[model samples]
Target: MTLDPQTLLAILAMAVATAATRIGGLVLFGFLTLDRRQKRAMEAIPPAVLMAVVAPTALATGPAETIAAAITALAALRLPLLAATALGVAAVAALRAMGL
Candidate 1:
């Protein structure tokens, strides 16, 4: 199937907008200075963003996902973020396999 000119242009515009947003964040952060409070807040952003993206679907889906999310959140307190996230995924898979 072929995209019409307007559709193609819209897609291109969206791509550019996404790129600009990401690049602009990097560029802005590069020259910015942060005090302790600001730095702490900045450090919190990743997990918050991750939860924002993950929570709705995780909670909305089933008990397995909800339990997995909770396990992951607790793990995050002691484990690295990546490890915690992986644990969450594994937990969900295991729970599903066990027919939870």
Candidate 2:
């Protein structure tokens, strides 16, 4: 029911700092060229970050989710992103439906 001025100011400052750093990275990348390995590493970043964020929660939930996450990871090795994601979703749904 109340908003604190100091907390709001801190939040605004953090937002500005985050925006500045993101824009700065874009500007810096614009002036730089990455070689083959660097390019590949950069391209893999999004998925790596995604897994890092999701792995803990997925594994911690229960056996059903852990199995599905493993299935998804293995599927990702050979299948396209969309297909792998769909398979993972289906696996979890089926497992949960069976009272996992």
Candidate 3:
């Protein structure tokens, strides 16, 4: 499928906008100094963002998803983050395959 000129321009605009935001954030932060509280808050941001993204899906979904989420949480407590995520995905795939 061919993209029209307007579509191409729009895509280029989006790419430019994304790059600008990313670079701007880094540049803005580079010259800043954070206090202890601010540093801690910055560290907390990632997990908070992750929970915000995952909580709704895990809470609203069916038994398979619930079970997978439980597995993910348990594994996360003991295992590395990537391993926990993989385990969660595997559990969900297995459960769905078994028609849970």
User: Which candidate wins on TM-score?
Assistant: 1
Candidate 2 — which pairs collide? none
Among all windows of ten consecutive residues in candidate 3, which has the lowest summed lDDT?
Answer: 43-52
Report model 1's TM-score to 2 decimal places. Answer: 0.81
Against the hidden reference, what TM-scores do the models get? 0.81, 0.70, 0.63
**All models: lDDT?**
0.90, 0.86, 0.82
What is the alpha-carbon lDDT for the whole of candidate 1? 0.90
> After TM-score superposition, what is the CA distance of residue 76 in candidate 2 from its true location, in Å?
5.0
Better of 1 and 2 by lDDT: 1
Q: Is candidate 2 or candidate 3 better by TM-score?
A: 2
Question: In candidate 2, what are the lDDT values of residues 5-96, reduced to their tens digit?
Answer: 99999999999999999999999999998999999778666556656777999999998898888888888767766787899899999999
Clash count per candidate: 0, 0, 0
Expressed as tens digits, the lDDT of each residue in 1-100 for candidate 3 is 8889999999999999999998998999899999999997776565456556776898788778889888877776667667877998999899989888
Best by lDDT: 1
Candidate 3, residue 47: lDDT: 45
Query: Where in model 1 is the C-alpha error above 4 Å?
Result: none
Better of 1 and 3 by TM-score: 1
